[model samples]
Target: MSKRATIHRMVTPDHLCPWGVKAKDLLRRSGYRVDDRHLKTKEANEAYKRENGVDETPQIFIEGRHVGGYDALREHLGKGPDPKEGKTYQPIVAVFAVTGAMAVTTMLSTSTSATIADGWAWIRVGELCVAFSMCVLGILKLQNLQSYANGFVQYDLVARHWVPYAYVYAFVEAGGGVLMIADIATLVVAPVVLVISAIGAVSIVRAAYIERRDLNCACVGGGSDVPLGFVSLSENLIMIAMAVWMLGKGSV
Candidate 1:
């Protein structure tokens, strides 16, 4: 018999609670038979919270013992807290994974005879992935632009001296990505992208390698705990490579 657990989480038309989803997934992964309860309305959800004397939803119960919220459930299951001090690659990995899929799908949609055998197709995929990754990353940063600017200035040599640069960097990156994707103004966009990416690469090298300082990367987002190192450096280098390729190819 499996360990039985019950979870009451919010699920309304407009809002599906992410923590609730995470809690349920975690329970399933931990070998628990979960009785997932949905509080389908705002009023009902509030009432349940009030009756249970809990401040939030996604409350868990195991063997009739209250396990509290998601964090509490993690503790109850003997899983320690997520490492805040330690670096993580999960966010960056997820970003690239989505970008890669999008790149391939884009190729397929644009070309009737799209195949991996075509070297140009592969090059286009590479370019698309790099551009899309930049756009995605920029969007992430722009979600909390002020926070991103603060975090970015810590290591970016240009941002350190010119604080305003950090704030506008996301726009620049995303705009470049858009231009590259549209194959518009390649002569203008490619050189600009190359310069920014090269500067970013240099900044990462100076901060991570030369200084030997441990810092969180603002490449994905300001709130992310991703480390400042190879992954971040590679993001810039890949963008640089794409920009150089575009410049050489003279647009499409």
Candidate 2:
């Protein structure tokens, strides 16, 4: 026979405790025959809490032994706490994935044969990938411009010196990306992107690698919690490389 679990959850008229629902679901999924007890009133809930000597609801008991709350129950079930409970790379992943897809689509559309053998074709694909990634990142930053600007001052050299630059940085990146995609104004955009990205790269390296400051990266936007590290540096380097490549090609 499976072990029995009792979950005491609070469900008032106006409120249904989310943690309680999670506890009940976890217990059921863990092969426990759950006896779900709903405390539907404040008095009843308080009485239960007082009786159990626990300050919170959504208390769990497995085989008549107290298993505490959701986190405690997870431990009791032999599963450790989630490592990535707070931090996430979802925004960065989304940006890169979309950029890669767009690059591939552009390559396929422009290619003459099944395989992309032309060197120039590959360069165009690379440019598209970098440009698209920049556009996406810029759009994310522009979504919450104030937050992005606040975060930017922490590491960006220009933004630290000139506050207005932080506000305009996202627009610059997006504009450059659009021009790159359209294959227009390479003489202007490439040099501008190259200089800005080089400065950003230097700033990131100083803050993250040299100074060893543990901070959040604003690369994916101010809303993201991505760490300030190699990934951010890599982003700037990619833009620099793209700009250099475009400039070199334009000269030829």
Candidate 3:
């Protein structure tokens, strides 16, 4: 028999894709080089069937024998070699591991960027929020702080103004910053930060409460925040656990 025959393996980047890898390794053992350059797209798979007569991964041929699918390949190679143990949902396990890892990484990266190292860093980060806060605080700043009354709360609080409240927050933030760097009160701030992140993530589910349409985004490369959407919920579950894990370790 001529050894010129080839095996064509079609594989998507799915959990069983690793099974494709295993198939290739076995192919090499069986004296055939498997080609898989065009394996992921629907067009490619359809094209393969049009060109050849098969439409599946690990499509095998032994010296032009047309041995067929994975089971055929198994028989040609001989039995009693090894038995694959019953592994439940191997593909799902792989997918979950990958997706969970990615979401947690994203959340950690975002939280780290929003945080400032000390009072100095806090002042700098707060300055960036000034524009947004000021827009909320606008012309009202010109009037006396007492001039504005909250009809709902019925309490006269500090009138919202960009420059005025921005400065106010900046000054108070200095203390939180110092506390973080000094590690004097990390426990208190850590819980509050987690709570804030949770609220921020959940509030997006309600359209009326949406102040800004997108995330601050400078901290995360994806330029999106983890809201309460399905993807966002998954991200937050991982992140919330990470926060708890760090808290348990007491590392802040």
Which structure among the candidates has the greatest lDDT? 1
Least lDDT summed over 10 consecutive residues: which range in candidate 2?
A: 82-91
The Cα local distance difference test for each model comes to: 0.90, 0.87, 0.42
Q: What TM-score, computed on C-alpha atoms, does each candidate reach?
A: 0.71, 0.83, 0.28
Question: Which residue ranges in model 3 land beyond 4 Å of their true spot?
Answer: 1-5, 11-16, 33-37, 50-55, 80-252
lDDT of 1 by residue, 94-170 (tens): 99999999999999887767465689887889889988988999899889998898889999989999999887788
Candidate 2 local lDDT, 168-226, one digit each (tens): 77888989998999879999999999998998999999999999998888887775788
Top candidate (TM-score): 2
Off by over 4 Å in 1: 1-86, 114-116
RMSD of each candidate relative to the true structure: 5.5, 2.9, 16.9
On the 0 to 100 scale, the lDDT of residue 100 in model 2 is 88
**TM-score-superior candidate, 1 or 2:** 2
Better of 1 and 2 by lDDT: 1
Ranking by lDDT: 1, 2, 3
